[model samples]
Target: MTRALLSAALLLLLLPGAPAQVSSQTSFTIVVSNSVTNAGNKTFSTFVSFRGILLGGMRRLQDKDSGFTFKYTEDDNYGPFLESVNGLAGCPNHRTYWELKVKKPDNKVILPDVGIGCYIPSAGDVVILNFNKY
Candidate 1:
């Protein structure tokens, strides 16, 4: 009976139904810039829980920094679409939109294929919200 119990315990340990691993929170930075107007960039510090989306960190930053604010619209197909930041709204008529980019700690910059609601930021990543005309 003891051997059977041990086998059962070992099976449970090797099972795929085990709880998912949890990770600690990670810190990153966010930079807001306007290439269309040449406005200076505003940098803010924020953190995200393990595997948390960028929108969560942005919401946290907005809550902590009075100077930081943002708004988004929910799309039935594409999830949340960023609409405005710091009173500057992206105008479709003007061909202006907020571009999402990320700079890693090693200085490699990349444009994520996903939007803010889906992108999972890593530690020391610099997320850039650039306003530009496309």
Candidate 2:
């Protein structure tokens, strides 16, 4: 096309994996601030879940709501994983665990919602999530 368009195309071709700033993820960790809490009639856990997509280790449900904060450590690979705290098999106090799932065009998946969270880790990459005990 024009000289300017040609130059732009050349520049784009020169760059490698321009879509991904760096490379595929290698390692990941989940930090749970608060796990569980008892309130009047309901016992609940605060959680943030996701895969591939980095999430917060700490997040406020609201500015005014008061909640407990707890922490946990996770050391797992980058595949399918479910991170969660034990709960009654059948309970209403338990909300459906929040989750984050990512499926590739190739039919591969990662992370989940419910417990603390999940990850598709990369080397030297850290994922943090914030939650309050309900």
- Top lDDT model: 1
Q: Give the residue spans of candidate 2 off by over 4 A.
A: 2-4, 15-38, 41-66, 78-115, 119-134
Ten-residue region with minimum lDDT total, candidate 1? 15-24
lDDT by residue (tens digit), candidate 1, 43-101: 99999999899999999999999999999999999999999999999999999999999
lDDT of 2 at 126: 29
- For TM-score, the strongest prediction is 1
Q: What local distance difference test score does each model get?
A: 0.96, 0.36
TM per candidate: 0.87, 0.28
Error of 2 at 119 (Å): 8.2
